[model samples]
Target: MTVATDTPLVDTHFHLYTRDMPITSWAWHHPPEDASAEQFLALMDQHGVGYGVVAAASLYGQYNDYVIRCCRKYPRLRGTAFVRPDTDMYTLERMKADGIVGIRLFFRRVPDPPDLNSPEYKLLLRRVRDLDWHVHTLVSSPALPEVIRAVEEAGVKLVIDHFGKPDERLGVDCPGFKALLAAVERGRTWVKLSAGFRMPSREAARSYAQALLRVSGGERLMWGSDWPFAAFESGVTYGQTIADLHDWVPDAATRRLITADTPMRLYFGA
Candidate 1:
C-alpha cells in the first residue's frame, strides 16, 4: 500500500549488520536476525520510501565493512561510519567517497564518553568538518550538554538520534531536552524523529514531538523508522511507523516536510 501522505519518504536512521561481522566485545542487543541493507531497502521500496540514511551500528564498533559495501552498491543509501578518534584524514576521505556522509558517536551506553576536548577527538571532529559531514550521536539527555557543546564548538553539523533520548521521568521539562531545543535554535543541530516505540509511551513520544516542532519551527527536523526495531523488534512493523508519524503530526503539509522534502534534500538530494 502507498504511504497515506504519498511523500517519497527518507529514513534518516536505521542499521545494517550481519552475524559474520566482527562484533565488539562490549556489544549489546544481539537480534538473531541480521538487518541487511537489501532487506531494509525492500521494505522501503514496498512503502514508497525513495531513500535512506543507514546509521552506523555501535554493536559492530568500527567494523563498517557491510555499511560501506551497501552504500557503494546502492546509490539510494547514504551512511555513517564509526571509527577510532585517531583515524586519519585519508581514511575519512575514503569513507566519504564511499557515500558515508557523517561519523557516528554512540555514547548512550558508555558510562564515560571520550573527551571531545582532547587532541585526538578534536582532530577527528576537525577532519569531519573539513568533509562537510555531520556527527550523528546517540547520547542520553544527561550527557547531552557536554557533547552538544563540544560538537558545535568543533563547527560540525550534529544530528541527535531518537529525539535526543530525553529522560523518561523528566520528559519535556528535562534539561537534556531543553539543551536539544537550544541547539536546534542555534541552527546547527537536527533531531531525528524516530523510535517512538522506544519511548515510555505513545503520549510521551507525542509530547516530545510537539515540543520539538515548536522549538525547531519546522526546520532541521526529519523522520525515521528506526527500522528492524533491533532491541524492540517483536511487535512493531514499518507500516505502523508511518502511521505513527501521521498520528503524531496530523497536518499533511507538515508531514510532507518531515518525511519527504527535508530528508530527501538532506540525504539523497532528490
Candidate 2:
C-alpha cells in the first residue's frame, strides 16, 4: 500500500484517553485501549498520514488533558473537545489557541444533542460559532437530516461521522441516507468517509461513500481512521483502513480532495 506523494492523507478522527477521567458507561462495545502520543505519531509515519485530528472520545468526558498533551507533543496534529454546555467562551477560546478546531457532540454515545435550540445550549453554540469553530456529531444516519438542519441553521459548520452511519439494514436509498446526500449539497455540512467496518458491510460502505463523493463534490468530504478501529475489531490495522478508501471513492483526485485538500482547507486554513 503505497500512497502517492501528492496524495497527502489527513486522518480526521482518532482518540486518546486518560484513566483519571471517569469512564463513560456509554462506550461499552470497545474495551479500553491506550496509545501514547509517540506511538500515535509513529503509527501515522508508518501509514503515510501527514496529519490526524485527535477527536475527544466520549470515555474521556470533559477532561481533555490527554488530547491537549497530544497536540503539544505533535504540533502537526489538531484536536476537538467533548464539552459541557456551561463551559465559558474564554475556555473555548483557550482551546482554540491550543489547536482545538471544534467541539464534538459524540452523538452516537449520547444520541440526544441536549437541545442546542434551548436558551442555554443555543448560547453555547452561538459562542462556538463566534469563534469560527465547527460542531462535529456522531449521530446515526437516520437522524442526520434533522440534526444537520438544526446545526446549519444555528450558523456553524458540521462534521458528520461514519458516512452518516448509514444503516446497512436499510441500504443507501434509505430516507436518512438520502437526506444526508441532500444536506451535503448545502456546503455547510461535511461528512467523514471513515469506519468501513462499522457499516453493514464493505460493499455498503463503498456504495455510501461513492454516493457521498458524487453529491459532496469532494470539498465537503473528509477522511478519518476512527483509529484503534474500535468495536468492530477483526485485527485490521489503520493502514488497511486507509488503503480500503480507494475502493470507496475511486477517483484519484476526489481521493486527494477528501483525504487531504478539504481537511487542510477547513481545519488548518491550508
Writing each residue's lDDT as its tens digit, candidate 2 over 1-270 gives 554334447989887664455666665554455655677788888767888898778765677877876786678889898788889988888888888999888656564446666787788788889999999878777777777877888899888888888776787888888988887887788998888877777788888887887787677988888877666546677766776787776678988888888898888889
Candidate 2 residues lying further than 4 Å off, grouped into runs, are 1-8, 18-21, 30-32, 111-113
Lowest-lDDT window of 10 residues in candidate 2? 1-10
| Candidate 1: segments with Cα more than 4 A from true spot | 1-3
Evaluate model 1: give its TM-score: 0.96
lDDT of each: 0.87, 0.79
Instruction: State the TM-score for model 2.
Output: 0.92
TM-score of each: 0.96, 0.92
Model 1 clash count equals 0
- State the lDDT of candidate 1 residue by residue for 53-125, as single tens digits: 9999888888999999999999989999988898988988998888999999888665446789999999999
- Cand. 1 Cα-lDDT: 0.87
